[model samples]
Target: MSNLFEGSTFCIHTFGCQMNKHDSERVAGMLEGLGALPVDTIEEADIVAFMTCCVREAADTRLYGQVASMKNISVREGSPFNKRLIAVGGCIGQRDGAKLTDELPHLDVVFGTHNLGSLPALLTAAAQEGGHRVEVLDAADDFSSSLPTDRENAWAAWLPITVGCNNFCTYCIVPYVRGREKSRTLEDIAQEAQGYVDAGVKEITLLGQNVNSYGRDLYGEPRFAEVLDAVDATGIERLRFATSHPKDLTDEVIARFGTLRSLMPALHLPVQSGSNRILKAMNRRYTREHYLDLVKKLRAVVPDIALSTDIIVGFPGETEEDFLETYRLVEEVGYNQVFTFIYSKREGTPAASMEDDTPREVIQERFDRLVDLVQRKAFEANQDEQGSVVPVLVEGTSKRDTSILAGRSPKNQTVHAPLPAGVEIDELIGTTVSVKVDEARTWYLSGTVVNEDA
Candidate 1:
């Protein structure tokens, strides 16, 4: 096929989870493959695409506001194209479809989570035909991993072992927008991981809505442990997965924490709420006690594992007692990090129509208390890392201080260190180096370089 987008400059704005980020990378790769150059900002590009999220009402508002603002941006005087093309894809496009162009009349192309590969064609049609071209597929025709990728970091990659979700949590729109669970074949995933490793990638984070349920749809049973084993054999240095549902977290997968050599010692198991009544209402399929037991089992195997979680402050019919339960659970978990959110009613979710009598002030107050507790717990967790030497996979120079290098430890803690004497920041961007802890803050650690050769 001819490169239809030859010489055009494009930029993509992405929102939401790692899955969406990976999707954007694939979109960038596709555009680049069609002979388009990537620009850092929308104003500089002939095409501006948005990979959107509709998980929270806030995300919808943000997407609408940003897309609306682009109506004022005009094509550069000497640009390669006659006009700027605006495209929207991912969750919001999947949900709203043709309605999006109606809402944002300037939108030219509307793709979706399932039809990301259709973006170039749609954009071409819109450009030549001069009308809105929207194609929102109801199901995925292929695994997106098979598509080319333009990873932001050459040393790191997001590999999706599964796409979509089956668990219809009352408060979540993910299952509805993303469709049912569809696991990629284990062989395909292993081969992809091997490819990343062969290409000098240092880290691979397995992506899925609920990673614990991986391979269930394809193999008729959850084989996530085997997936880990397969990826671990690929010789990747750092491995991780996200958004594990507590109910589906099996003993076999938990054992991998102690056994897998390449698996990082960090987990993002989201316990959305700690009240059993609220959990039941959310259709999470696990009680607070069951979640606590799972945590206990995880700690027993990997005692020093860094734990992070997501929590919702308020839901329908939540009372002070329910809120207390959540507060107490946070205290007990003592997580290294907590992503707390005040409940935002997504329109299609069941919770949206439920009785939410909790006042906005009450929810905000609860959120504030949770944030304070989370910060304290995080500070305490970092304090434990003080005086220890850790190997950090360097990301880049710290944004707050240029002379300092910033990276993540195996537990995913942000560890910063001064540049080695005579060493340039670029030299250490993707290399692993040892840092001896000198200070521990609430969210990150600072240290001196202990092993420059690592």
Candidate 2:
């Protein structure tokens, strides 16, 4: 890569999951490697890139609005970033491809999910050719972990063990956009974790669409448990993984929670709907009974595990009974957090073509009720932490009040403590400090520092 764009700066507006966030970090690292500086806002930068997500219609709508605003700014007479290059990357770019350039005439470049390594060359071409340049690979040429990353948080980093999805859920477009599953070599992952620990990374989260299915492609069997063991051996302070599929969450994997010292007592397993009828229609491959069984195994191993999940309120043909089934499951499980959504039909997904007679008002009502139950459960979970001194890995100063420093407890709950009189703010970050939980709200916990050497 040549430094032809040296002295330039960039700002990346990212949307969607942790994977997308990690991709944006790698993009920033590549730009900086090409001698570009990082900027706070799009208007202040020479190039503004969007790491987009197309999982829902809302994401698409947001992208269109943001790009339109940037396009107008580029043409504005007195704008500082009037000549800025507008680039689109990630899932939306992978899906939309040349269509994005056609839609947004101001769009300078488009690169796909698997085409991140090609970004430097794509940017160079866009700058030199002065035309809309697009490069989206049919399949992943290289794993993103192989690329450099400019991590936003110094305390932690995201290590993806697997890329793409094998289970083609009827409602998800991931398989079409991200292609088949590809597992990273175990040695490469472990080495990376060691490097992060050496760089003072207090925690690391292994990322994947279905982390439980990791290593099946390579070894002909799921080796996520082994992957966890290898990474934890690197001496990392804390470990976490996300977005597990209930169908593939093996007993061996569930057993890791209680045994692995570094593995935090938290899991985010998405069960789109609790109704077996809805799950079968969605091609989720797991029934309501199976999900509860997995939950049972998890609790049996790690009783205090903070469980979170994703629930879609209204599918195409969902009935009141189906919705009530979900309500009952939420009550039974008492999830520490619940991400509820009204299902949006994507054009290519099977669920899109399914017959739907469910009314919009009914869906909205169900969504509100679900939210009420989830909030209550969340508050109860937080209340359980009262009077407990939890080990919180300090992240930084809280957003609402800078005087209070914020960090995540072992359960991944946000814990904030007032900045102590004697300690410097910088010293608190990346260090696991013990805070006696004095107050607990539905969303966060407030406490005072009891011990700094945690």
Candidate 3:
């Protein structure tokens, strides 16, 4: 890597999941190593990069709109760099490749999920040739976790034990764009986690497309439980994982919730739909009964665990009965949070070609009903915590009011507390404090700081 980007100001606009966010962080770290300074906004940047997502149609629209809008903006007038360069990477870049440069003629560099390390070279080439330089590799040459990172939080980190997805759910584009599952060696994962602990990180979220399926490709069977034990052994204060598939979630992993010291009492097991028919059509590999049973076992082991899920309401050919089954499941689960989505057809996905006679308005109605149920269920779940004391890992002050310091509880619930009289906000940013809940809203809990040293 040359110092071609030396003294340049860069800003990265990230749009997507934790994996994409982590990728952007690595890119930032790489640029900074080449002497580029980070700026808050694109207008101030001599180099603008977009870490994009193609999971939903809305993400595609937003990325295109933002990239197009940059055409009229220029680099900061007083900056040393003479011209601004725009680059796009992540899922969309992998999916679209050189087509992006054709669509957005101003694009200078286009790298993909598999070739993040090539971005700087591509940028250098673009600067020399004054033309687009695109590199989209079909397979990953290295695990991204091995890359340098400029994490957003000094005290928290996203640790990827695996990358990509093997399960091709009918509605998802993840497996297509991210490619097949690739698990990093367990020894490598633990070493990185210990490094984070040594660097004073308080939290680590193990990231993967389907976390419960980690190590299956490399080890010949899922060893996610062993991965959890290794990370927990690093003595990090908190540990979490995301985007679990119901089919791959085993009893061994569930058992860790009751035993692991650093594992948080929270899980995000995405059950896309509740109808067995729709589940089969979506190729989820788990029936409604099996999913409910898993939930039961999870609760039996860790009763106070905060459960959250992703639900897609309007899948192709979803009937009224199917929606009702989903409604009933939501009522039964009483999740702490629900990420609801109306299905959007992706060009290469199997569900995109499925027949559907249902009217748009009918789907909209089902979506609205699901949203209503989800909100009520979330509110009820919060209400259950009204008088309980929670230890919150302070993130920062709330955006709406600086007087209120905000953080997350063990269950990953947002908790707000007034800043104590003598304590500065920065002092509490990375520390855990005991909060006594006074009120519970639909989205968060209001509390007072009861113990700062907690």
Q: Global lDDT of each model?
A: 0.92, 0.90, 0.92
- List the pairs of residues colliding in candidate 3: none
Error of 1 at 222 (Å): 0.3
For model 3, what is the C-alpha lDDT against the true structure? Answer: 0.92
User: Which residue pairs in candidate 2 have backbone atoms (N, alpha carbon, C) closer than 3 angstroms, thus clashing?
Assistant: none
Q: Write the per-residue lDDT of candidate 1 for residues 1-454, one digit (tens) a residue.
A: 2355788899999999999999999999999998889999988898899999998888899999999998899896666556789999999999999999999998899998998888878888887778899999889978888788899999999999889999999999999889999989999999999999999999999999999999888878999999999999999999999879999999999999999999998999899999999999999999999999999999999998999999998898988899999999999989999999888888878989998778899989988998999999999989989999999999999998999999999999999999989999889888999999999999999999985556
Q: Write the per-residue lDDT of candidate 2 for residues 1-454, one digit (tens) a residue.
A: 4557777888999999999999999999999999888989876788888999888999999998899887556432433333778899999999999999888898899999998988888888778778888998889866998888899998799999899999999999988888899999888899999999999898999999889999999999999999999988999999999879999999988999989989999999898888999999889999999999999999999998999999998898999999999999999999999999999888898888999988899999999999999999999989999999999898889888888999999999999999889787798888988899999999999999985555
TM-score of 1: 0.98
Which of 2 and 3 is ahead in TM-score?
A: 3
lDDT accuracy of residue 263 in candidate 2: 95
Candidate 2 at 314: error in angstroms?
0.8
TM-score of 3: 0.98
